[model samples]
Target: MTKTKAAFNGKRLFIRLYCPREFKPKCVTSSVPVTRKVSNRASKRIKRLAKPMARPIRVTVRSGKWKKVSYLIKPGFRNKVSKMAGKRKRLLVVRDRIKAKKFAGRKFKGKSRTVFHKHRVVSGKAR
Candidate 1:
């Protein structure tokens, strides 16, 4: 279950290169003098972006991850999240957080994986 979500909403690579010309690498990445530097630059830029976005995606009502996004957080969703949340006050709604925390040593342990961590599960003080 956890593994599936990890792969589903996986991260994406977005890059706008500084390749000043159009006669780019004919086939692929190469040692050609002209394109090598450009390609390397692009690669470096990608690496930089990856590092920042690579942070674990945690789910918390307080967190802004799901800010503008809308999902039908109705009774069914509440029930599912409650059943999952159980006693723990954390949940990994996005998926990667589960992998990052390695399920928090319980193979189910996660950080801020609290389904309703902010509403009623943990306490009225969660807000």
Candidate 2:
């Protein structure tokens, strides 16, 4: 699960860069450039846009060596956010059926991965 709805939308854009990954020589990344500097730039931009929202949004960036795997796992949301105020309503629908479980499984391109995260949005009381 992700902390913000914006991430679900951004995944489509990021997939075009990291999917079907390949290994290149040193000083190369994704056949383009995906360094910490580049990721930091993107995270800053996203955080700026989220400033207008009722709550803060968390934008995470995965850095380090490039791997032959997808940057995003799968989209999942909690039922609580359905009636909550925010943006990106279309992508906020709850996908995880099981409640009280923090581990989710996913199989992408014959590769299995376990995603461990809290689906519920943790925040202070609303104003």
lDDT values of the candidates?
Answer: 0.22, 0.23
lDDT of 1: 0.22
Clashes of each: 7, 0
Query: What is the Cα-based TM-score of model 2?
Result: 0.16
Candidate 1 per-residue lDDT over residues 1-127, each given as its tens digit: 1211111111221111111122121111111001011212356665343222123222222211222121223332344433433354443232121112232233323222211111212211111
TM-score of each: 0.19, 0.16
Clashing residue pairs in candidate 2 are none
Off by over 4 Å in 1: 1-72, 88-90, 95-125
Native-structure RMSD, model 1: 21.3
**Model 2: per-residue Cα lDDT at residue 113:** 22
